[model samples]
Target chain A: MTERADCRASTVSYAAGMLREQLLSPTPVDLRAFLMRALRPRDCLVQVGGLAEVSYHGRAASTAEVGSYLVMIKRDGSLQIHTPKGVKPMNWQPKTDEITAVLEEEQCVLLASRRSPVELVRVTFLEVQMAQALELNEEAGFLLTGSEAQMQETLAAHPELIEPGLRVLNRELLVESGGIDLYAQDAQGRFVVVELKRGRATQDAVSQLGRYVASVQRVVGTGVVRGILAAPSITGPARKELEGRGLEFVEVNALPLVEKRTSQPSLF
Target chain B: MTERADCRASTVSYAAGMLREQLLSPTPVDLRAFLMRALRPRDCLVQVGGLAEVSYHGRAASTAEVGSYLVMIKRDGSLQIHTPKGVKPMNWQPKTDEITAVLEEEQCVLLASRRSPVELVRVTFLEVQMAQALELNEEAGFLLTGSEAQMQETLAAHPELIEPGLRVLNRELLVESGGIDLYAQDAQGRFVVVELKRGRATQDAVSQLGRYVASVQRVVGTGVVRGILAAPSITGPARKELEGRGLEFVEVNALPLVEKRTSQPSLF
Candidate 1:
């Protein structure tokens, strides 16, 4: 990394950045100590990528098959579990009440939990690959301006705007009935079906949202789903039908935003 | 990495494993060549972890904020994107029709896509972290034994057992109404609500599934989710109610399994 810079442009973000010397090959005790101290500061974004088995319990119970994954702990009390593929996080707790790590029976075990509704995400790292706590900016909320895609980006990035502790599992999710505007889990861990209408929502908007809800209801089988139509305004007819369908409505203004994120430009 | 092993247990999965060197510091041209060749072999699992901007289209449309992520492409025509935290992949396309890489604007751009239903996952690598194609055993599908947790673990690993091309995003996921047995995406790109029954799926099983479905339906506003009740057998009443709710049923056997996977034992 210290090699003299050549004419070629660097594609490496951390060009000369080396993972702390000791971190290159961290021991279990090292990992536990690093995780504890890293979580205490709550300043740097702590990331550990390696082999692990993860399990979650609370709203919906789940246990993942053994594999490698990247575990990120953010200062916002959010712990995101990410697999090597996809834009959606496999399992996540937007904000945790407590995060702790311990070396149990020779292996490093990390537990992140929240109390309100009582949710827990537990991960056991069998092998540590790279455990680096990087300085990442999460408080600089982004202002994205564009069409429905941009709105989805802004809202997805800041789910709190819709509801505190709300997490959008996936955006532009395709389901049988049609493409859903947003697929999310609520604060209480309920599946939230969101239909984002950039302008004033009227007419068929209610029915459109209803169809998507029905499709999910039939498929989700036994899971409660909440349908929400988010827009600046709603028509009386749409509002009336929405109530009959038991769907909720939230007002969202399509404010002109000044883009601030260093996001990837649209693929032409 | 060249260091000799000492008394300390090695935590690195690939301790002496170098990232094919040129891949260590890959240029746009080098990355394209590396990715294309790695994917073509369809033997070694191609993993590229670095700083990149990713977006997904088809079955759903999503654009992620600019950041770093790990991109892994498997021989199974699957592309997984991993964030720093969580067991679930941020975005994924299981069993794609084709995988390709290109150099655009002096940047390494990789695409993994499927023609059927036409889904696509595009990743623009702003910086390549580690691009290594390692030989991973996928055919050695696991055999897990135990109780309900094992059942879920088995299904999550071999989602093909439930249905081909079905990807179980997360297991034991907690939702509002109750804990979902499995959260998966169907081959057709729709959200699939799955309830696993290790024993006879009868009696109030239908009602239980119904509750979970309703929760998800209410939450997923405009998406079609297919509800599936999987178990060994079902009573006539349960079957009747399942259809009445438009929920489909699949039969699964809880046969005594012989544990074979190099799986980690339950953390005491």
Candidate 2:
């Protein structure tokens, strides 16, 4: 019989309960243990404690590999531990203070401090393959760039369409080495950074873009850096406030290549 | 000629800046303006008042269908209208005090007394589309009962797997009215409602599932209603915390119809 969507949902819930039971039972698997099980053994684990550290074969490695281990921390006392795969389970069990101490002694220093009393500790494997699969190739970089040369070429060809004194800069350096949507210079020689947003825009993106601008100003001098964003859209008021901050607002026609099919395939 | 990644990035940045300048220049045709010009005759105009409302040609149903609008209440107690799509030039400024008074007259209240003098208002289109779509499936009771039957059949074999009392009931009852995801029950007579998650797992899922539970409980009894989620997989800790509250968690196994693609597409 064709498995109906409701049936699929219920069965999935049942499977989930089974998994939960397996995880929360007395012989609970901690977040690290769960990760060791889900990810390839070679996949390194990093714990960003007071400082960042890597763990391998149950031993803390002296050095950390580039993007080797996934970092997880509970923002509040929520104590969330997101693994490369997703959330993992913590070997949390109801134990008296004495038993807890004994177990802590056995587990490791990481498990010793119950900062938030480990309300729940889970380690779900993240789809790390996606991160691994993400290749910063010429296509991604070129698309990510708000370069001057490229803009110049377009402007040169479409001179009648664009204005004069617009200078385009490529891969404009920001303080932190994180992905920037785009960075450019204005006619007045002031820098204008444009961050292109495709998916659901987060406060983090705006805040981070602000940081990039701040960083650039810190390096180049104050009042030199400005910010802008080009997306198919923005939520209520974001565009205005972003513009109000002296960040220019420019709307671009979404390139045809930025389509949904690049992400998921659907049956027609 | 090979396009250096840096070079491409620079080109993109430059293009973005040039585009921004062109859009802001004295008489430039920008995308925002182009869309506005095309849609204006449809009674659509960028709203500058606090409670932004726009009209469209087809049906000016809700606020979301209108052109995006941003209103800023500057420190000088003046209101600024940044309708980038308006026929008026960007620099063709209007009287600030007059506009502010007009906006205030239009019930344009500031976002906060002093904290934020400005707020951006956006017209959302999805809500209208969703409302219209729901109209198509008008037989609410029949649809709900049909969905319940499908859920019951799928969980019949696994009835004993979940809590002892869970079972499907009420042809007229529904788990969710939005109709975006599926829902069902467990063996314990508990109403186990399942939600299909498409995005990456975040604590937000828990809040949303909580809402689903509340909604289902409102229709059913709170004592009998339980919430569960079926995604590709949930992280260990998330699953644990959710389960700790008696909520079920499930992981889905996606397979191809051909069966041959199964091995390659497996999500283990």
Report chain A TM-scores, every model.
Answer: 0.52, 0.36
List where candidate 2 sits over 4 angstroms from the true fold: A1-166, A176-180, A200-204, A222-224, A253-255, A258-267, B1-268
- What lDDT is reached at residue B1 by model 1? 35
What is the DockQ (computed on Cα atoms) for candidate 1?
A: 0.08
lDDT of 2 by residue, B167-251 (tens): 5443223434223144556554456666545323443455456556766776765477767665546765556546655666765
For model 1, what is the alpha-carbon lDDT of residue B117?
A: 64
Best by DockQ: 1
Query: What's the DockQ for every one of the candidates?
Result: 0.08, 0.01
How much is A244 displaced in model 1, in angstroms? 16
TM-score (chain B) for candidate 2 is 0.32
Q: Compose the digit string of candidate 2's lDDT tens values, residues A1-268.
A: 1222222122101111001111111122243344333222322212221111222111111122222122222111112221121112112222111111111223312221232232212222211211110010111100122233344344434422222454556553434424454556667877766665543344334545655675577677757777766544565445544554565444443322212555554211
Q: Once superposed on the true structure, which residue ranges of model 1 sit more than 4 Å away at CA?
A: A1-25, A40-53, A60-77, A80-94, A129-268, B1-25, B42-75, B80-95, B129-268
> Interface RMSD, candidate 2?
27.0
Question: Per-residue alpha-carbon lDDT of model 1 for B1-268, expressed as tens digits?
Answer: 3221121121223323212222443566778887887788676557675667777666445666666566667656677776654445577887788788988889988887877666677898875645666543312122323456767777888888888899998777776556888889999988888898876786356656665676777788788888888887888766876787799888776554334446666433
TM-score of chain A of 1: 0.52
